[model samples]
Target: SIRLPTPISKPDRSYRVDVYDRPQLAAFMDAVKDKYDNVDQYHKLAYLRLLAFTGIRNGEARALTWSDMHLDRDEPFIDVNKTMSDNTGHGVVINPPKTKAGSRKVMIDAETANILKRWRAIQGQALMRRGLPSNVVWTNQRLSGRISSNQPREWLLAAIRGTDVPQINVHGLRHTY
Candidate 1:
């Protein structure tokens, strides 16, 4: 049998973005208001807020579905079912989470619950306008062939382009929460 030496741990100097202030956060979302319609705005905001609130990875958020949402129960939660990767724009597909612990339910607060409700309502209307079905929570309908996992980065960049923001990346928003 062959034995391998233990790997050394490197210092985690990577930027932890979960440090945004309320005003900055508000400004960031407000700036993107025009880039999306009511449904798209709600969807982006809901997903971003979920990332911020739950510390879930972008892949996890992208793979969420209406079936995973437990909105009726008092302790409303999102079941972390799967994660996704860029599959060359075919469509978003489900994959396992990074670890066993990553595949769990995350309970959301009332504020997030309200936002999810609003997004659900707007999403239905948006689907109706596009003549698509309402079963899928996230879709590429708005971005031609782009997946939902990539929208936050693009949308956030567009949001803060002309603003006085310090160029914090969208992934940073997850850490800030």
Candidate 2:
């Protein structure tokens, strides 16, 4: 029997992303939550957390609806059946997940579930006041896919501004999960 040294785990050369350590993650998230919440941007925090905690894609998070969340269950999950597409020639559109395998359950931790639950109530009220249907989680259907693709990265920068927490894009945050 031959014994070998433990192998390194980092991705060698693929399109790998750097991950945030626990404290860095917490600090960045705290800053994002504080800045957004101060301006009443509840959905942004929820969206960010879902990406970080569940690895859900931006399009999928944008396309989420109250109907797609099962937050009351013993094990809460998001039903990722649809995604938002912004690059379509016609305009932003909702379509099926990128692949058959994309349509699956994404279980979430309690903290994320609570954030979503509170956001749902807030979103419902907001949509009602605006005379829009409370359908999507992140935004109304018309603006779902229209949000600038760079918004998440911008949010990350804003949160990390004046802080030592290293900057990372939202997609990379998903990889951290």
Please, what is the TM-score per model? 0.72, 0.81
How big is the positional error of residue 87 in model 1, measured in Å on the Cα after superposition? 3.8
The per-prediction CA RMSD against the true structure, in angstroms, equals: 6.1, 8.8
lDDT of 2 by residue, 1-177 (tens): 999999989755343237777887898788878777742677778778888899988888777788999999999998999998677577778899878999999999999999888988877776677677556566634533335556767777776777767767677887788
lDDT: worst 10-residue window of model 2: 140-149
Cα error, residue 151 of model 1, in Å, equals 1.7
lDDT (10s digit) by residue, model 1, range 30-50: 665545436546677676667
Candidate 1 regions with alpha-carbon error over 4 angstroms:
1-18, 21-23, 26-40, 88-92, 129-131, 142-148
**By TM-score, who's the top model here?**
2
lDDT of 1 at 9: 100
**Candidate no. 1 TM-score:** 0.72
Task: State the local distance difference test value for candidate 2.
Answer: 0.77
lDDT values, one for every candidate: 0.70, 0.77
Looking at model 1, residue 12 earns an lDDT score of 64
